[model samples]
Target: MDKSIFTTNAALTPALGYSTMIGLGLFSLALAYIVRLYLVRNTHDFIIADRRIGFGFGVGSVIAVWTWAMAVMMSSAMTYQWGLSGLFWFVVPNGIAVMAMVPFARILRRNMPEGYTISEFIALRFQQSKVATGIVTVTMVFGIILEILINLKGTSVVVSTVFSIDWRVATIVGIVCVLAYSYFGGLWTSVMTGTLNTLMITVPAAIVVVAVYDRIPGGAEAVFSAVGAADQRNLSVLRPDAAAGFGITLAFGLLAATVADQTFWQKVWAIKSRDVSRTFLWAGALFYPIPICLGMLGLVGIGYGLVPSDFGGDIAAVGPYIVSHIGLPLTLILLYVLVILAACYSTIDGASAALSSIVAVDIVKRYFPGTSESKLFVITKLSVLAGGVIATVIVLAGIDFTTLVLTTYALKTSVLLPLVFAILWPRTNTIGFVGGIVLAILIGMPIYQFVGELSGTLAIVAISGLTVIVAGLLKPQAFDIASLKDANGATSAPTAGE
Candidate 1:
């Protein structure tokens, strides 16, 4: 491995960084315009695409939303730091987490066919217990906000690092670009743009991975030798050390992220019922190669003996660092940037779309009751704009990407068991559901922040799970699940296609 390449600070010009952001933003705007011109006529079309999305679009949207910028950066960083075990721990749970939502989505879509948000269902399930519904709503809102912040933060860090642009400028540009399109077509735009973004992410990623490996002096074997020499465990797929450190934490945390998130739930309603299971199954399968390909860059970093210091002491910067320093052609470098930007753009728009659903159905409609459909429609778009502004402000505050991700995961994980019980178990009562989440937040969050990640996550799941079970046993109440059919009130007439 040549150490000399590390000395030169090679980077793309700031113009390229700004241009990429502007270009993607304009592209998303075009998609939104098309959607508005033809598809989005009301809140239903805007929020959930009239609940008629088919398999192709559904699969693409799922893959795009699931491929967050953090997934690209962190997958490599984990492998770079913890070896193959790190990649295994991160990638396996991630794919499975999305697939795990299949049963939940199937049941929820069947039971509450007209539902728009998970929190809305929680309200109905708990007999509209304000405390229980509020907990889930707040958890989801914060989770989505964190989703926006993390993707923005990830894009900013990568752009600034590889293009010599200021992180603040990158952050603001990324959010504004996403909001420009997301505000117009809502979920319709998100799905259309998300499918395109999926292509940008997957195709470019495969090319870059092969290019990097081909460009290496000793090729795959040399890279392997270099990595193995540093630490033999880097070659092992089943390193017990990584399983203990990353396996348990990511397994539970990632599952919580998918199940508790309104993003997946929004898709549940947006997609056709028959396509739901297969869409998720294919989406999960399609998602595997992305992180796997990106994780190889972590090995490339190790092969070249690059350390965190080379990338400003940020492990999450490993992917960008490799792409910039590895001497790839200028075209491939730009392609790599497109991949990151695409991941960031797709997810930001997806989260914003989900946020709009919550605002329209859960908050504004629920509270204002008499608010007209026209007003509800307008409020939904406005909520997305508001979310973009809030997320941008927080990103400018300079929070660490890893810290934001872990904290958000912890918060989401706290509600995992309680939420699952609410959806699946008839005996899950309001007292248990509400009490479990409250206790998890009150107790588990402190441990998460102050104690260990694993311990904190475990504590949250344990506390919430125990509370729900005990409450159910003590005060067993078989909720009339059939009544949930009318939970969202009178269903609107099906749109033209449906």
Candidate 2:
């Protein structure tokens, strides 16, 4: 619980942090524009990269977009707070969330090959009921907004801490950089930058662990001893406290969260069909090391006698605090900068693309049907800009990032089961999809806040499924899956170079 040990050390300074931010930011932005010159030419290219994305970019997109700053920072914080078992609880479910998307991605591509957003598919599915589309649109929008806001908060806070810069300044610089690259190619920009980000995070993370190994008081053995001394179950995968508190809840929460994300769904439509399953599976497997490796900072902190309790409930500081004290060389300090920036930028650009896709396809075109593709493309770019600006405003307004994310996710669990069932089950009707989600939002959220996350999430998902089942029994409206072939206007255009 003492902080005096870190006071004398200086791994990085404000000037270095600022230099890294501007240099990396400009380089990424310029690279995005250059890639855009070769790829982006139409709305089709912007939204889904002309549906020709290959295995490498697809896997990179999956890994990078999903590796938000919260994952990078909080996983380490949780490890510091809860011990070894904490890594398993956070990492496994996160992977399952992406892996679970494999089957759904294939199904979605088959059913709505030209789909712009999942909300677009929902609209096509329940043509007679506007409520379903409305539900999907509203939730997905809020989800993307909260997604961007939280990552921005995480990035700015970490950058501010390490660089001794103003959080507001860090946020503006980061958002502007994200907005620049994202404006160039939309989804193409996201995938390109994401690929770069994946390399940035993975290599640096591996290096940091190896570099810091000797700094631990007694090495791995000492770290393990401290872990057990803190709590024996810290080394076990089945920590009772973790399971009851967050393990199961977070698992289901991430499942719901990923299912409800437009960013992942966008990739589902973007990747080539033959490669969909492989891409998702590879991403799932590769994504594990990011959070797990970063978590060593926490374990090493434990070995060095700095635990979460020492930070006075702000466990988010544990990662930077560890790095600051360990006497990291200049190279490792710069490497740490890339890890954080990449984590934040990847998701930020992905969110921009996802929100713009929805705005252009679902909101703008749906409301103003006569708009031309050229006009829609312009609107989409503007939406990307607007999404970045709005999230920045929210972060600057001083909202609590964690609470905003939790609130957005609480709404998603209410609708997740019905949304999934709507895709998989023939008996799911508009009545159930609409009414169940509505009631769950009204009722389940209160329970989530006052009762418990696990109980509330389970209750809402059950209520949603039950409502659909009951509606099917009462007045079944059989849906024709064959109709989905024509659902997204027409068959998708051929892939680039096909």
Candidate 3:
């Protein structure tokens, strides 16, 4: 909280009385055009860079997409709320990432050559059945919408605060910038921008962490030692009090989710070689650690007299807090703007591309088999555009972090989780796979809606687990097992034709 380079109003103002929002808008527009020039093309290109992505780009997107406003903010928020248990949110995901990489990747890389989405993967490998695809699609699309909305809200608020403008304008400005860039370059542009974003955010974030700590009382050690009273119970990987209070049922919801996250799956399919995908796994292994560092910073804030005493503090404040506290050199301000854009758009673009690609290749072709590739491509792009509009609207509706997280995780609970678990466990029969999904909806939806799990994690674990169990107990169907085995066999850079 020292050095003087970022005078509040000065940094917020544009030179020569420029329309800051409009200038930011144009800057965003230019970025989008550059992305389009670098990337935009067919549906296949948009979804997985036509399966031509290199190591750094793929690694960068995979990482950036993983850390949106929620990921970064929530990790800190959790730490603020629960002390060490908060760290589990990040740790679990990394653990889940490792859990997924062992059996999932090689087959995923081999089988889905131009993999567009989770729906396409399930449809192509298992049944291409309407029931199956519909089930997965509904959950994934909704989850993505929730994720996007949360990110939009975070970015909008940050921009609004920094610029002293209305949040709504910030939201519109943010979305337009992303949509414009996405409109131009497509996936190529997004990935390139994503890599730049990772670097932009990482450097400042690391520095902010170090600088903030040096200034804080007792630094990290004092913060950690003092964080003990924040937790009501032992810091279990699965918090039992929160678990029972919230009705959590699945010990591995995070694991089930990682298996089906379309963001990372697209990354898996984009890479040129199976080995490059390994780079992502390594990156993922280390991905959640950033949250821990960020969370620690939040604890430090509490340790110092910096935290407010009047009301309950919010840990999501780690962003604005760090940026404000880290005085001097002022580069962090510029760095944060870049990070916000990167974190927000990297996921949004990838999500848009995945949805569009799946619709173009998998959904449209199935219904209108005779449609030409060019026409299918148009339809897919249009669908993506539609999805973008819808997602933007959802954000406009205004959802809090708890609502956003619950909406996404619960939806995934009823549909995608069962499907993913079925894929992961060899013994899971198709009957079980299908049944589990349906049962998850019936059981989870009621709990999510009527029981009001609200923001807690319990509902997600329970609903998803019940679905798998119910589905498993149902009559096994004559599934096309050979295809799955074939896929698993071909996971590690199997011949493209395999």
Candidate 4:
């Protein structure tokens, strides 16, 4: 329990902690500002990069944005607990969700080319129902909250575990860094910074794997054997408990999360028309590895006999738990900090940009009909700042991280199946859309609140989908997909930025 360097149980010195955060985080901010200066010509550029993102940037942005704190930390933590089956269950659902969005991205581009967020699609699809828009907006805002929670968890873990810094200070530092550059460039800034951060994340991850390889007991074979001994089913890809419980729940939950998330929708709009499928495919393929590689740290830790109790029972501490045991040099720890910062910033900027677009396009213009584009642009920046501040307050309040994550996913699941059906099925009606979501929340949340996380999630997806299908059957009404073509009255005029 002694906290000193000689004991190999010390917090990162204050000097090193502050220096690493400022060095890596601020440099990314500076580079982001420069990119914004060249790319940010108008509101469209700020929100969706003028809807002309190239394939490389598109893929990088998707991977970076989606690789939130949960992707790196929780993915490993689950594997630490559930073993190989855990990693398989976690990564597959997360990757599949992004890949599955490819066709929808093409459809959105072909129809609502000027669309800024998924809410626009909802508003257009259910023109007569402000309730639908309201529900979607609320759900998207919750998605923003989910983003904040992710970075909050990442920064808090790195700072608290490594530096002995109060998690609040880390939260404040992260918020300031993300808001500063995001305020300037929006999605263009996110994509460019994401490209850089991807390198930062990739290099460190690769280095860690090589550096730790020799140290792992029994090497890969020993790690697998230890995992199996720890839990009879741990090393099995089809571990029954994982396959039936966490796997099924996470599959439905993540599918809902990706579909309902404005961050993903914004990416869909940002990339070039021809590159939509390729971008998503690349993003999914590239991102799938980072988590798996990181998850290896957990298995190695298990092989070395490390346990959750070492990190105060917080599963997110799995990565740090392993790192601490490696007796890594301070330099390596600094590199680890940079990796965490990269993950945090990528998602924070993406969420800020996504939330701003929803506020600008869905809320501002809808309520204030005569709002000028310039004013709307200003409002978007303001929303980003406001969201960062709100998220900071929530993080500082010290909410239960696990519950926050599960609750948000449950809320999202309530609306997700209905939204998908509305978009893909011609017979899907507003009655189905609104009523199904309402009924799902009424029934599903209680399940989440009382029964269990997986049960609650499954209930929401099942009930929502069933309601949409049943309502459509009872009062079938085919909607012309072409009706969405000019939902926003956007013309062929190129943006000023373009």
Per-model TM against the reference:
0.96, 0.95, 0.80, 0.94
TM-score, predicted candidate 1 vs. hidden true structure: 0.96
lDDT accuracy of residue 100 in candidate 4 = 80
In candidate 3, which residue ranges exceed 4 Å CA deviation? 1-41, 98-102, 112-114, 217-253, 305-314, 325-329, 399-407, 424-430, 448-474, 477-498
C-alpha local distance difference test of each model:
0.87, 0.81, 0.59, 0.78
lDDT digits (tens) for residues 110-153 of candidate 2: 87777668887787778736778888888898999888888888
lDDT of 3 by residue, 200-255 (tens): 55776777677666654566665455554444342344664544432233334455
Candidate that beats the other on lDDT, 1 or 3, i.e. the better one: 1
**Candidate 2 residue 184 C-alpha distance from true site, Å:** 1.1
Q: How far is candidate 2 from the true structure (C-alpha RMSD, Å)?
A: 2.5
Model 4 regions lying over 4 Å from their true place: 1-11, 400-407, 490-498
TM-score-sorted candidate list, best first: 1, 2, 4, 3
Clash count for candidate 4 is 0
Cα RMSD of all models vs. native, in order, equals 2.2, 2.5, 5.4, 2.9
Q: What is residue 287's positional error in candidate 4, in angstroms?
A: 1.5
**Candidate number achieving the greatest lDDT relative to the actual structure:** 1
lDDT of 4 by residue, 1-498 (tens): 111211244646766777777777688778877977788877778887877889988888888888876577777787887888889999888899888888777777787777777877887787647898888898899879778767876787677777787778878876887788889988888888887889888889878765665555456776667766777777778888887768888888777768889999988878888898889988887888898888887776566566567666888887866665566766676776777788888888888888988887778767776777777778888999998888888778876667766566766887888888877898888889998888888898889779987778778888989999999999998787777775557421223442
Angstrom error at residue 424, model 1: 1.5
lDDT against true structure, model 1: 0.87
